[model samples]
Target: MNTRGFYDELADRYDLMYADWDASTTRQGRALDALLTTSLGPGPHTVLDDACGIGTQAVGLARLGHRVTGTDLSPRAAARAAREAAARDLALPVAAADMRALPFADASFDAVVCADNALPHLLTAEDVRAALAETRRVLRPGGLLLLSTRPYTALRRIRPTSEAPHVHNGPDGRTITFQLWHWHPDGERYDVELFQLLPSGGTWTTHTSGATYWALPEEETARYLREAGFGEPVLHLPAATGFHQPVLGARRPVPHTRSTL
Candidate 1:
């Protein structure tokens, strides 16, 4: 399946990927908020979760008092995000939008977050640049951009074919999730098959979804950020940031004003 179709199909089951969705949201939010605060300052700042799926980060950030807006490429996922936020009584405005072309005025937000390895789905350098340019355009001068992605450095080296499964037991039953990776010969792109084994009456049912990604490591992503007009980008690993994935941060540089003639 394509990216949108894959996410759309997985929207309802997305939470199943997490052992405890609610707790994951809170933990991720705390880490992201701390990272942002340390990089920028304390905020109730206007923020955008550009690739928000089922309101994970957006809802958590909103709960922590930031004014957050969420957008996703999948309409179903966006709708699910909105509903999830509403269910928690949080005000998160969500819409279906492509990251390469956001529907907002220029310099509209204090920060933009494209987390959870979303950018690699672009699959090509040109597409990645377009999205980064759009993200930079939406940020006010000196505004922050937070991006999280898988550890592509080692993946490029080892080329693991499959990920370890995560099994979760809830009140209803048990579910197991894992991924299979098929790398292209070029060594920079791969197709992912996400498999979820769900409990059924007397039997287990398997559901599968697929998408492609480019193996974009920190150095390459930072280069794209700079090319798209952001300031020098910094990489934060999970060990240092307490985040689940590697996070990169960059800022839009403030323009210099000329002295009076």
Candidate 2:
């Protein structure tokens, strides 16, 4: 499926669908707030919300006194984010860009945030690594990188054929329909697809377009972080915070000279 259109169609109603499903928008907002505060220190002025969807959390960060730049693959979603920023009388630079290759210069932001299982949208380990590399490149030395992914144990507990209705509210004040398709697990990776139904009653299906996730254990994710050139990552479990089941906080290493150089 073409995820671009799927998200574009749901851009206006993204919030409503999640509220109906009992998803925690407030908790997510707080998690993002805490992440920004912890990583960039108090009162950060600049931030990047990668895969920012409709700028929900981006707005929250801005409300907390940060200058936010939000990016997403869907143009409609980006526009929605821009409108939301305007409504709040905040300055948000919303752009449509790919996660694997962001349109920014090195050390461009004080911090980068990719929440809501955004990492899983990339289908392979290479994609994940590339996204991380890009994120690291855009962050200042000693900058913070905060991200969340599904726990492997949780993924293991679910069946491949399981179906769930994930809803979102569009800017037009209508509930958007989304159908989730879960596939059998393959090694550490699993496949999932999202389908959006038009409010007019017809189904407009977008294929996963190679959507996959590597359900990395906390240890594995930390190892990946270290390999990606970040400092040691601190793991936070859901018990610590009512947000993500497991959150990883890592810092980009401050540049150092090699003795042999």
Candidate 3:
């Protein structure tokens, strides 16, 4: 099965499934806000929400007065995010696009954000670097790139049989499903199979999909960021700030000009 297609199919119900994860969301948002305040100073402005699933954080940013452009790999997710933005009476440009090849031009944005362990979706360190490069390419000189991801060690602690329940409203009806998963460790990689149960009449259809991604070390992540032309990353625990610890903040390097010889 196409894992990407599964996410697209699950987009409508995405918010409902994770609404109860409020504590986690609040923490992450607060951390992000802190970084924004410290790095770029206060103010609402244009920002890109890369891999914005269902627009939860994007909506929050819009509500905070930032003009947000949210992008997702799934068209269904983009549609849902756009609908949410509309419901809030906010104009958010939600586009269906790949992170590696962002459509925006260079120096087009003031900041770029990728939250909720979204980096892992790329499945490789090179993909993460490409995404970061695209982010750097689009952000103005000295602009910020804020991203959060679960540490490699954290994934090891997650129980194999864990399942999270999510609900979504669709044209057909309310679709409620459980995101059940079993984590299988392979060296530094985690093979994750996610199961969803869809209620059809009285019967529930079980759909299984999976993806594999490297659990990269923080040192490796920092190296990639530096290689991609980002400044050093600052680590902070999500529990401390109500978000992922060490919200990586990097600045786009400003090019130097040679004096007349």
Candidate 4:
């Protein structure tokens, strides 16, 4: 299925992957806040969540008082994010846009975030570079860029097939979710099948979705960040950040010139 269709199928139920999804937004938001503050500074800064999905991070960041705008390839997902924000009485401007090509002015934001393993969705080096270039273009000079993805360094060798099932209560009843990963021969790409067993009246119903991602390692990702105009890219492991995935923190370099006699 196409990216938009695949996410559209999963949008309404996406948050069920987490236990207490709302609380997770706050936790992830605070974690990102600490990272942003430690590197960028303490204050209300403008942020763009380029691959916002259903606005989990965007809403949380908005609650934290950061001017946040979000975009996603799936129109349904973007709309859902807007509704989610509104439900919380937060104003989060979410638009439908591809990460590879953003529709925003240059240097318009203090930070650009592509969290929740969003970067890997681009399966090729060129595609990743294009998205990174756009992300850097939207950030002000010396602005921060944060991205999160699975620890492919170790995950690559393991080639994990699935994750533990996450069960959550839905409007009608309970929902059980899990994913099965199918690795490509190249070892750098994987096709994932997301399955959900949802409650329907007295019986359970099964729904499935598909997606592909590049198993881009930390070293290669950092190199791509530099190629895309970010400097001093640093890899932060989950153990250190208390996040589920490793996050890469980098910044746009401020232009400087030496005085001549």
**The best candidate in terms of lDDT:** 1
Cα lDDT, all candidates = 0.93, 0.72, 0.72, 0.90
List the candidate numbers ranked by lDDT, top first: 1, 4, 3, 2
**Higher-scoring candidate on TM-score, 1 or 4:** 1
Residue 94 C-alpha lDDT in model 4: 89
lDDT tens string, model 1, 1-261?
A: 899999999999999988999888898888889987887789888999999989889988998999999999999999999998888999999889999999999999999999998999998788999999999999999999999999998889999999999877777698999999999999999999999999998688999989999998789889999999999999898999888999999999999999997
Over 4 Å off, model 2? 20-27, 163-180, 185-214, 257-261
Which consecutive 10 residues in model 4 have the weakest lDDT in total?
236-245
The model with the greater lDDT, 1 or 2, is 1
TM-score of candidate 2 against the unseen true structure? 0.79
lDDT value, residue 34 of candidate 1: 90
Q: Candidate 2 at residue 183, lDDT?
A: 57
| Per-model TM-score versus the true fold | 0.98, 0.79, 0.82, 0.97
> lDDT score, residue 211, model 3?
58
Per-residue lDDT of 111-162 in model 3, one digit per residue for the tens? 8988766777676667888888888899999888887776656555554454
The residue ranges of model 1 lying beyond 4 angstroms of the native Cα positions read none
The best candidate in terms of TM-score = 1
Write down the lDDT that model 3 would get.
0.72
Could you tell me which residue pairs clash in candidate 4?
none
